[model samples]
Target: MALLAYRDKHILSAQQLRKLSEHKYSCFSASLLDPLLQPWWNWLVSQTPLWLAPNLITIVGLILNVVTTLILICYSPNGVEAPPRWTCLLCALGLFIYQSLDSIDGKQARRTNTSSPLGELFDHGCDSISTVFVALSACISCQLGHYPNWLFFQCFCAIALFYCAHWQTYVSGTMRFGRIDVTEAQFSIIAIHLVSAALGPEIWLTKIPIVGLSWNYTILVFITFGYTLNIINFLKMFTEGGSGKNGSSVAVSIASTSRNNEAKNNYETCMKT
Candidate 1:
C-alpha cells in the first residue's frame, strides 16, 4: 500500500514546507499531509531499517490534546480568577506537542511500512477533536475575563477555517488556505497561538484603544475580515486560477500534453550545461 506506507517518507516540495500549516488533504483532510512533511518524514525514513517500535507519535499527540483540552475546560479562564500559570503553560505545551507530532507520525509509518488507511484516518480523526478543543479553550479563557468580542471572533474564525478547509478539499481535491494550504499554515498558527497562550490574553488584547468599543473586540472584527476574505479568495481561485476547461477529451489531452512539455523543460534544466 504505497498510499499507506511502512516508513512515511513525505514527498513535500520546498515551497509547501514553509506553508505546511495551510496545507490540507481535502478528503482525509490531514492524510494528505504526507507531501508536506519533508525533514520529519526524512527522519522516519532513516529509521526504516530498524523499524523503531516506540509508541506511535499520533497516539502521543492525541493524548496531549485531550489533556490540554481537559485542563482548559476544568479550569477555564472564565471560571477561575486565574487558573494556575502552570496549567495554562501545560495546556499550551499540549497543543504544541500535538503540533509537532501531528507532522511526525506519517513519516514514521512511511519509513516503517506502518502506514495504513486506518492510521491515516485515526490521525485525522484525532486532529478534528484537537481543533475543537483548542478553539473552545481559547475562546472561553478570553470571554471569561475581558475580551468577549475577541473570543467570539477567535472561536468563529477557527471554526470558519476548518469549515473552509473542508469545503476546499471537497471542491478542488486540494486543501487550501488563502493562497496557501494546511501544510503551509498549520505550524505557523500553532506557533502564533502558543505564543499568545504564554503571554496570557492581555498582550494582544491591549492593542485595542477604541473610543467606545473594547479594542479586543475591534481586533476580532478585523481578524474576521481577514479570515472571511481568505476563504473567499480560495473559493475564487476555483473559478479563476485554472484555465476554464470543460469536460473535453481534447482539452484534457492538451493539458496532459502541456504537462509533459513542462516536465521536459524541468528535466532539461536538471541536465543543463
Candidate 2:
C-alpha cells in the first residue's frame, strides 16, 4: 500500500531512534517528593500485569478524565446550576484514579523494558489534555464559575503554569516539578473539593480586601504561588547561562549526562538480574 511505503520511507534509523528515546526520558525533572512516593509507586507498578502495556495505562487515565468531564458537564449544565455537593466527591475520586494511573505508566514501561519515544510523547500529551479537566473541575469545586473572570483565570493559570514548566525543561534540560508537582496540584484540588463539600462552593468566592486591590481572590493567591515558583526557576536558569549562546549544547550535555548515569544504573541492575 502507499501508506505502508510512506511509513517505511520515514522510519527512523537506529541511532536516531536511540537519541529520540533518550531525549524523551531526559525531559522529566521530578519533584522533590517523587522519591518519598517511589516505594509506593514501585509496589503499584510491580502489581501491574506485564501483559498490560504502558500506553494502555495511560489510556485508562485519559478515560477516567473523560468520564469526569462528562459528569461536570451534566452537573454544571452550561454553568446554569451549581453542581450538587456530591459532585465534588466524584471529581476527587476521578482525579485520584487518574493521577495514580498517570504516575504508574512510566514505571510500567521501565518494568517491562518497553519504554519508547512514542510512549513519552503520548504521556505528556495526555497530561496536557487532562489539565483542562482538572481546571474545569477546580472551577466547579470552588464555585469560582459564578464569577466568569475568576473561572477563566483559574483555568488559564493552571494550563499556563504547566506549559511554562515544560518549556523550562526543553530549554534548560531540566523540568523542575519543585516541591509542588502535578501530584501535589492534584492533592490540592482534592482538598478544594472536600472544602467545597463541607463549607459550600461559595466559600472560595469570598475575597479579602488588599491594599492595592479591591479584593483578593483565594484562587488568585494559590495561582500566584505557582507563578512565583516558575519565575524563580526561570531566574535560576538565566543565572546559570542556560539562556546564552551555548544554551543548546549545554542543554544537550545536561540531558546526555543525566541519561548516561541512568543508563549505567539500569545496566548494573540488569546484570544483577
Candidate 3:
C-alpha cells in the first residue's frame, strides 16, 4: 500500500478531499497572555499593508526565528557552553517577532478575504518545526547540555507535547489550550534569554543555598512537573473519548459518515434512473 501510494500521482484520497472541503477551523485557547496581546496583534495587523500576503508574513517570521536560533547553536553546538550574551538577546528578539507575526497572520488572512484550510495547515506546519528549534535554543541558553540526558529529555518532551496537542485536536475537533499555555511559555523563554543576556548564562549555575540546587536544575524540575501534568491531561482526555456522537473522534467520524451518506445518495439516484 505504501509503495502503491508512491506510484500514484495524487496524494490525497477522495475521502481526504471531502474532509478537507468540509473542514472548519475550531480552536479554544484560554491562554493567559493571548487576550492581553490581542490589542497588540490587532494593531500590528492594521499596520500591515494590504498587499502583503498572510503566508509571506508567516514564512518570514519562521525564517527569522530559525536563523537566530541557528546562530546560537553555531556558537554552542554542544549546549554545554554558553553562547554570547548578545546572541541570547538576538534569539529573544527573534522569538518575540515570530510570536507577534504568528498571532496576526490569521487576522491578516481574514482581513484580506483569503482565508482557507491551506493557511491553517501552513501555519501549524511552521509551528511544529519551530517547537524543536525553540526547545533547543532554550536548552542551549541554560547550558543544559552539561547534563546530556536532561537536555535530550527537555527537547524531546517539548516536541512530544506539541504533537500530542494536535492529536487532541484531531480527536476532539477543537484545539483546547489551558490558561498558562504556549504564549506564556514563549514569554517565559524570552525572559530566560533576557536574563542570560543581562547576568550571563553562568548565573544559572549559581546554587540556591537553602535548596542546594543550581538555578538551572530548579527550573528544570518545574518544567518537568509541567510536562508530567500535560501528559496526564492528554491521557485523561484520550481515555474519556471525544465530544462527537457515540464517543467517536469528531473529525474522523464526521468525515466517514459524510462520505458514506454521499455514496448512498449516489447509489439511490442511479437506481431511480
Candidate 4:
C-alpha cells in the first residue's frame, strides 16, 4: 500500500494524467525501408494469435535483443575484443527479430482492437533502452573500441540523436523520420555484425585504398556526417516551432504550469477562509 501510494504521488501529477489521457500519437516516417518491409510486417502480424498482447510481443522482443547483445558483451566487455563469430551472428539475428516484432506490435494491437496510448508509451520505452544496447553491440562488432574515443562518440552520438528525435516530437507534436533513418541504421548494424561473423572483426582494420583510413574509421566518418545532418534537421524543426497556435509546441507543459498555479491559488483561498 505504501509503495502504491508513493508511486501515485511521484510517478505522475494529476495534470500529467489528464494530459496523458488526452494524448494522441502522431508520427511521420520517410524511412526508405519501411514500405519495403510493410508486407513482411503485415504477414507476421497476421499470423499472431488474437490472444497475444502487443505489449507482450514488445517486451519479448526487447528481452531477446538485450539478452543476445549481453552475450556478446560478456565476451568483449571493453568492445575492443571480438566475441565468438557465432555470437555476432546471434546478435544480428536478435536485432532483426526485435525490429520485426517491434514493427508489428502496433499492428497486432490494432488488429485486436486494443490500441492505447499506454501501448505506444511502452513500445517507445523499450525502443529507447534497446537503442543503447544496439549501439554498443554494433561498436563491439566493428571493434570500434580499439579507438576508445571513436567508440565513445559513436555510442553517445546514437543516444543523443535518439533523445533529440523525441525532443523534436515533444516540441512539434509530431515524430519525424528522415529518408535514411532508424531502419537504415538498424540494417547497417546488422550488416556489420554479419561481416564480422563471416570475415572476423579484424576486417574492420583494413585500410581503404586511397583514403588510407581503416574501414572502421571510414564508416565512423560517414556515420558522423549522417548524425550531423540529423542534428541540423532537428534544429530546424525546433526553430520552426510547433503547429499549435502562436507556433507553440505541445501544450502539455503549458497546461501543467497553469494547473499548478490554479492549485496554489485555490490553496491560498482555502487558507484565507
Candidate 5:
C-alpha cells in the first residue's frame, strides 16, 4: 500500500511530462576538476537502485555531517590542549562520506525519473546547512578555536561565500560554482583533516614569520578572493546584458523572469522524466 501511494505521488500526466522533458532544469556549473572524477561518479550512480529516493540520500549525508560537527565541537581545542589528532581522521572520513553521498543524490533523482525543482531546492537547502557544519569542523580540526572569535568568523565567511554564489545564479540565470567549487573545497578540507591527523593541529596555528599569517587565515584569504571573483562575474553578467535584456527596466524584468524561468524549467524537467 505504501509503495502504491509512492508511485501514485510521482506519477505525472502526459502533458506535464512533455513540459518537463523540454525544460532545462539542471544547473550549469563549470568545475575544473569535475571531469577527472566524472567516470567514478557515473559508475556509482549506475550502481544506485532507482527504488531509493534522492532526498533520503541527502538526509543521510546531512546526518553524517551533523554527527561530524558534533564530534568536532566536543573536540574543540582549548588554549591549554588540542583535540586528539586521530579525531581529525574521523572527521575526514565523515566529510568524505558526506561529499560522496551528496554527489550521488542528484544521480539517484535522475535515475528514478523523479527530479524536480523541489528536489533541487531541498538539495541546496541541505547543502547550506552542511556548509556550516563543514566550516565549523574544519576550523576546530585546524585548532583555529585558539584564537578568540576567529572560529565564528570562519563559519560566517564560509556561509556568506556559498550564499553569494547562489545569489549570482539567481540573478544571472547561470550557475558558476566558481573556478574552485564546493567539491574542491570539500577535498581540500579532507586533506587538511589528514594533515592535522599526521602533523598535529598546531601546524595550522603556527604563523609564518614573514607574512604574519597562519595557515588558517591564509586559507580564508583564498576563500575571500574566490567569493570576490564570483561577485565580479555577476557584475560582468549584468553590465554585459544578462538574460539578453537591456536598460534600467531590464533589472526588474530580468530578476523576476530569470527566477520564474529557472523554477519553471526545473519543475518541467523533473516531472518530464
Candidate 6:
C-alpha cells in the first residue's frame, strides 16, 4: 500500500529507481511508464496464471510489434499523402501496447518465483529482436506516407548505436542487462513515435522569405539527440566498461530457482493449498 502511493508520486517504483541507481540510464516513454507499471507488475506476480511466463508475453509483444511493422511497411515506398488519421492512431496504439508489456515478465518472475536462466536468456534475446521490428516499421510507415527516406536511416543509426551500446555495456561488465534501467532503450523507441507523428504541412519548422523552413529540423534535432546519447553511453562503457563490476549478474541465472524454493518453504509453513 505504501509502495503504491510512493510510486504514484515518485515516477518510478523502488525496483526501477534502484535499477537506475545501479545502472543510471534514461529514455522517454520508459520514464513515463515507470510510474504506471509497478501496480500492474505487483498484480501480475500475485496471480498464478500471469506469473513470470516469458515466452507467452514476449511473443505477444513480438507479434504486435510485427503487426506495427507490417502496417508501416504497407505504407512504405508509395509516399501516399494524407494517410487517414486512423492509420497513425493505430500505429500509436501498437507502440503503447509494446511499452506496457515490455518489463512485466521480469517483474512477474521476481515476484512469483518463476525466474530462471532460460527466462532471462529468452527475455534479453527477444528484446534485441524487437529493435529490428521498430526500425522496419518506422521506415515503411514513412515511405507509405511519402516521408523522407532519411528518416528511416536516422532510425537505423539510433537503433544500431543503441544495440551496440547495450552489448558493450554487458561486455564491459558481467554480460548482463539491468531490469530497471531500461528507460534509455524505451525512450529511444519513443523518439520514433515523436518523429513519426509529424506528417502534414505544419511539419515544417522555419520560414524564410524565399526559402521555407519546417519542423523537420526540430524533429531532426530529437533524432540527433538520441544518436548523441547512444554515442555517449557507448563511449562511457568503451573507455571504462562501467564500474569494473563486482561481477556478472550471474545470480539472476538462478533467480528462478531461488524463487521456487522460497515459495515451497512458505507453503510448508503455512500448511495451505
Model number with the top TM-score: 3
Comparing 1 with 6 on lDDT, the higher-scoring candidate is 1
Ten contiguous residues with the weakest lDDT in model 5? 241-250
- Models 1 onward score TM values of 0.58, 0.76, 0.93, 0.89, 0.76, 0.60
Q: Model 4 TM-score?
A: 0.89
Among residues 3 or more apart in sequence or in different chains, the pairs in candidate 4 whose N, CA or C atoms overlap within 3 Å are none
Cα deviation of 95, candidate 3, in Å: 0.5
Residue-wise C-alpha lDDT for candidate 5, range 93-161, written one tens digit per residue:
989888888888988887888988778878889999999889888888877766657667777878887
Clashes of each: 36, 0, 0, 0, 2, 12
User: What is the C-alpha lDDT profile of model 6 across 101-158, one tens digit per residue?
Assistant: 6667666666666666566667767777777766555444333234566666666775
Summarize candidate 2's per-residue lDDT along 1-273 as a digit string, tens digits.
999999988999775677776664554546766777778878888899999999999989888876876787688855436677777777788887888899999889988999987888899999999998888887777665567876777788778877876667666655556666777778888887777677766565565556343122555675778777777776666456354245653456666776788899999999999
Q: Model 5: clashing residue pairs?
A: 20-268, 115-270
Angstrom error at residue 113, model 1: 2.2
Q: What are the clashing pairs of model 2?
A: none
Which lDDT tens digits does candidate 1 get at residues 63-143? Answer: 887777678667664532444445556766776667667766666666665655456657767777677777765554433
Lowest-lDDT window of 10 residues in candidate 1?
Answer: 242-251
User: For model 4, how does the per-residue alpha-carbon lDDT over 23-101 read when each residue is reduced to its tens digit?
Assistant: 7888899999999999999999999999999999999999999999999999999988778999999999999999999
* Deviation (Å) of 48 in candidate 1: 10
User: Model 5 TM-score?
Assistant: 0.76
State the C-alpha lDDT per candidate.
0.58, 0.75, 0.91, 0.91, 0.77, 0.56
